[model samples]
Target: MNKLLVAEQLVVGWDAPVTRPVSFHLERGEILALTGPNGAGKSTLLAALAGQGRIFSGTLFRAAGARLALQTQGLPPVAGLPLSGAELLALTGASAQGLPPWLAACLPLRLDRLSGGQRQYLSLWSVLASPAELVFLDEPGNNLDRAGRAHLQGALRARANAGAAILLVSHDPELLPHCDRHLMLEPIS
Candidate 1:
């Protein structure tokens, strides 16, 4: 498998170091699970990898120009953005062919009208279907039902099979089985 990213004794934070020095790597066609309680710095590490936060210390490397996409937690509904679910998918070049009937129906509805699960599923689809080679997902299982999680599992597998490197944070036992590796984080301080 091709190596997509590497972190050597990496520490990340927004204003101050929130993660202890940690090391890890992500490879193509693989899923790396990031798990822990809140305040564990999982999201902060992701932010560093996505180039959104400070790499407070240590070294980080990526294969050439690895394209990265992030699906964050608690994305508020777009109350008046005038974007529909289908349009959102289109923006990411994602196809909703395998979506459940109810979710598929949401494709034409405005983003604000979709229920939480529908929006979460759609948000995940947008990233999984993106051209990005590396994807970072924080609490992807939020708002998803059993069926939605099943679909998410399938999608994660499909994306890995297609050679994308995934780093995801989720407490869902169902979703953990699909990952190739797991990294459990402990609370900072």
Candidate 2:
């Protein structure tokens, strides 16, 4: 089946439900955006779908044997970490060919030496370029500048076109155009 995931009345949170029950499905070769206000639990819902957060109620299912990759808001502290940008990408099995010229040049440098946006983009590329059939991203556009954002949009489109199911959580208005559909979450009252 082309469908990669199915969620029905999924109520997810740490302790109590932070979002109203939401139902959505994701299919290969599509880009879905999760959008809402600050407290709407967009991140939490993504975590739940990835099997890393609590599901207080409802059902969530993934296609059998479907591989997935998830990119969260947190970036591992680069301080004194020996990893380089290229090394990070290599670890994730992602190629650097599509990286913007600026980022590509920084690939040989230690991640700690790169600027915030550079590190962010490198980390994003690790997930985006992976071979996972399903990709979950949370606030991916964070720390990205205008050019970075444009590159991200293009990369997302390329990934979707290549048959990866992408579900990203973002508040950036510019990212809406790259999405095939959106699931808007309302904060629980």
The superposed Cα distance between candidate 2 and the true structure at residue 28, in angstroms, equals: 0.6
- What does candidate 1's lDDT look like per residue over 105-154, in tens digits? 77888998877778888888887788899989988988889899888898
Error of 2 at 188 (Å): 0.9
lDDT of 1: 0.87
Model 1, total clashes:
0
Best-fitting candidate, scored by TM-score: 2
Q: Give the poorly placed runs of model 1, Cα more than 4 Å off.
A: none
Model 2 Cα lDDT, one tens digit per residue, 1-189: 999999999999988788898999999999999998899999988888888889999998999998999999978777789899999999999988889998999999999989988999999999999879999999899999999999999999999899999999999999987899988999887
| Candidate 2 lDDT (Cα, 0 to 1) | 0.92
Per-model lDDT: 0.87, 0.92
Model 2 misplacement above 4 A: none
